[model samples]
Target: MGGSGWRKAIRGFNLCVYSPLAAEGGGDVGPPGASYDPPAALSPPDPPALQLPTPTQSSSGLRPRVSASGSGLSKRTCAICLTTMTPGQGHAIFTAECSHSFHFHCITSCVKFGNHVCPVCRAKWKEIPFHVSSDSPRARSRVNPVNMNRRHAHMSFQHPLLHNLEPCIFNDDETLDTTFKTSGVCYNGSINTVEIKTYPEYSAIPESISTDNFTILIHLKAPLGPRNEISSKNVYVDAEDSRTHRAPVDIVTVLDVSGSMSGMKLALLKQAMGFVIQNLGPLDRLSVIAFSSTARRLFPLSRMSEFGRQEAFQAVNSLTTSGGTNITEGLRKGAKVIEERKEKNPVCSIILLSDGQDTYLLSPTLHNGQHTQPDYRSLVPSSIRDRTVHNVPVHVFGFGSDHDSISMHSISETSGGTFSFIEGEGAIQDAFAQCIGGLLSVVVQEMQVRLECLHHNVQLGCIKSGRYASWVTDGRRSGTIDAGDLYADEERDYLVSVNVPPDHHETHLLRVSCVYSDPVTKEVINPAAVELKISRPELVGSQTMSIEVDRQRNRLQAAEAMAEARASAEHGELSEAVRLLEDCRKRIFESEAAKSGDQLCASLDAELKEMQARMVDRQHYEAMGRAYVLSGLSSHLCQRATTRGDSTNSGSFTQTYQTPSMVDMLQRSQTFSPATRQSNSKMRHTLSFPARPKPR
Candidate 1:
């Protein structure tokens, strides 16, 4: 009977307690009413067969106690109420260690009334702490204790639960914790958890979200790209469907007609201009400014609609070559033309083609200070001088060999324009096309980047934007404005090609931020933010991408450097040659680093290295040339001594054959040996006399 009663109690406990708990907690725990007391028959039938206490309704008219166990009556036992246990249905149960149970819902309400212990035994359940199981699901679901503590500290003043209820909530005081989740159990007693939901209040974004005045960002695609086979038919196909506001372009073509540019160079210039004119649409306008001794306008700000092909052809064909190169005057004239047309167009440009030489004016004044006469020739007029002063970009093209490329490059760089060199007449059209294409391709406008510092504790350093980019770094601490240092901040926006990462499909809003200092105020701004939306080009079917000439530009720059170094060496400017060579070396190094393929990079590296080695060899050759000349002079002097029969007259010979100190002898001791010197001496003795009138 005792064993049967024990079996019956165990069965009831398993069914009532373990099953309910396991079902309620998603199969993670056993049922609640698992404990049961032995039956009277099994316990010697003592104490009038003590029965488990039935649940009693409390003052709130709800069942409070449900079950009982040994040594204690069930606090409240209501089978009907207990059977209704379901999640979110208000029915709840809490079992004590003594196997006494009560309604969880009722108990919570009772505890709020300052009840610190179980009502039956007056035992403090709060103080009776239970160890959390390592593999328990509840323990696993709880927020990490350390993270919770950090979050609590992060929001010590504000309520954690309240803060997480909204979106777009900027935390002015929350500190990011870096050391919270290093190790140990996830949920200890120290952590707090904050639950954040999506923000519902931010309903609309303003069309112009920036708080500052309008800013413009012009993205210029790189002027060059890989050389691949492209079909000409696809070149004219429109790849983008969007219509951009095409700004009026004011262009001044400053052509070089110096004596050096006699035939092929001059003809190529004419042909390239023709190509440009043919490609211009009706809405576009053009201007032709030619320069020689003085600048002259062949055509000024004529719309393509009114521009006569015959007149343009006549103007170009009539160009004559004469005199010295005057680049400064040419640039000045181009700038003046654009300045005159600035009101007519927002975009103004100058296209200068030269051999890269500048000649100063010989006369002090002309027409009583109205004009000055140039010494040799002037391609650039004096009127364009103000453009450089005003920071206008000047695009320059160096044509043919014997051109002054260095000054032309300087002009382009100083003016924020591009510098290109045409190796031969054949490349002129291609170079012109690239320049024009770059000028025409403008899609984005009024672009600005705003940065907000998210991390305040870490000290930030100087931030570098992309090459040829600009940034703002000062003014009010939180608001956006125009007044700021150009190079002081990490947040910057400028014109640049958006290079899509591989396998990227959709456009994304990227917030690029970095910490930086304010140059004027010396305040550290953390996590400076520059927001940008990047999208892939909507390429159309069978469209031909325009060929970029950036690679060509780099190669051209490299070649130009080499040429400049040679010229410098020829002019006895060794230091200048070394400087130019070093620049060339650096460019080559960068090119190698930027190349995509190993084979191609290695090939280019080898070529550049060879060129560098050749440059060194050329310098050695120049040195050797000077030595050879000196050696010839020395040999001539020895022959003269033998002719005068002064073999022993070392003193007289020394005075007579004294050479200039400027001459340096070759350091070839082996070749100029004593034996060779003696042989030369004997030969001089045999042939020194003029054959005594041929023994007449």
Candidate 2:
């Protein structure tokens, strides 16, 4: 009668008994009338089908729902109701910027009944789209167009918001026309080597742009890692990967043996050329050409074998300076050498070093009190251009203060190459080293990006791709951007301003795809295209934006200021140039990225200050200031970091500043070893040479 007695009785009731025939070792027992027969073994029953976890009923008396996957299993749970959310089951899912997700109804109910914060994370709720019937008879409107414009303008200039809306940026009349002419500026140099990765700034756009337009910034980056500042091993590479192998280079070095490059300059030039030859590998090819009154190929393109390099050194050492400077002839000879390359698909480029202006190629005269700049592009043959000449970049170096910087910069820009100012005797070697470093580290070639608008209502306002050509087709619905060769891990950004209409409601806005060739494999790769989609709601909260987009936009604006300042300085408008630089500095400080302690913004700010100081008056502006400003502007516009110098002494030049180009920072930051690091360091100190200013 105790607990133990009850347990024993329950065990007896649950016990199982075998059949008599089975216990007696007989086969099986059939029906009573049938004879005994062997029985077959019984198989196990099938497992139960998978089912989604059904959420429990809520305290608020809401019915529990089960969210199911393909396997009919629930993966997500709603925090508010303690219920599973069914995706695509007429129940909307709201994802916050913090990446927390909840059922739309649950979150909205919570927000309405509770505080305006996420129930799960307690973070401020964001990006909740709303639909309201505005302009209804019962609805009171309090909208001000003028106030909206002012707010938009503030957001546009203070941060990387809608770039086109800022009047200070475009300085143009507002027009409803959507057609935009692509303004291309060379960010770096042209086509030659590796795989490039591309991605969009944001995954989604807010539905309503009735008050302000949306801007999309797409980034094309080389997968190069951050550089080791103290080491020469700058580019990060997986040795196991074939794509990272240095591409074979075919370079034509054009030197100026003009009368101006006589003593220290000539000696330094020879040394720089020798250094260039030493760095080249057996797979690389080199050629040398010298021009003064005429151009002559001192050395033809030959493999950089030990013996071949010896011959190159001899040719460089035997260089002599005389006669008038003939830059046009030098470039022509260099182009001719490139055309005669023996290597197939090698990284081809031209290095032009000049110390003086071409005596025959004169600067245009002022007409009607306006400075008529000479057409430097017309001075060079079509074959020398990047478009015509197999994308050969012509990297030009101005050796002295008197060297025609405008013409040199133009030639480099037109050819999709970079322009460097080499004033110091020792600086040329350093400049050459940096240039060659970038050349050898190329990984991607002939890169191009295409942006296609998915909706007809969505229009591309403009594409700000530094130095590369971009054009909108299909009546501005689609656009193709030419992104020149990127070095290992070098990133290029394209700020695309899109005009989205209010009536348009689509999930997908644009498609971005890139086509690039790998120099190592000699294979063209077109990766799967990425789509840009944003939900369209009648109204939405301020969405979280990409900091990278903001940073790139800020860079573009700073570069624009540099360009404007350079033009003002060129036309003898010193005060205007200074004003522009000051304005740029103010914007840089006000930028969100800058306030967040972005290093690039700080560098740009310092550069603007330096530029403003350089162009304070006409006397300094004409002396060495014009070339200094041009060099800075060129570096910024081209996105190619260059060492700029001014002659403090007639016998030698001293470097004044170096432009911190994004490409140079990303591509060649680790290029300078301790031995070669002196070049960049010594550039900071101003040396007193008591030199005479070169004639304008």
| Candidate of highest lDDT | 2
Put down candidate 2 lDDT per residue, 227-316, tens digits, no spaces: 321122211123332133446677889899887887556655664665566556545678787898987766456655433443454455
lDDT of 1 at 42: 12
Ten-residue segment with the worst summed lDDT in candidate 2? 3-12
Q: What lDDT does the true structure give each of the candidates?
A: 0.35, 0.56
Worst 10-residue lDDT window for candidate 1 reads 13-22
Which segments of model 1 are wrong by more than 4 Å?
1-248, 361-391, 444-452, 458-460, 463-696
TM-score of model 2 vs. true structure: 0.62
Error of 2 at 474 (Å): 0.8
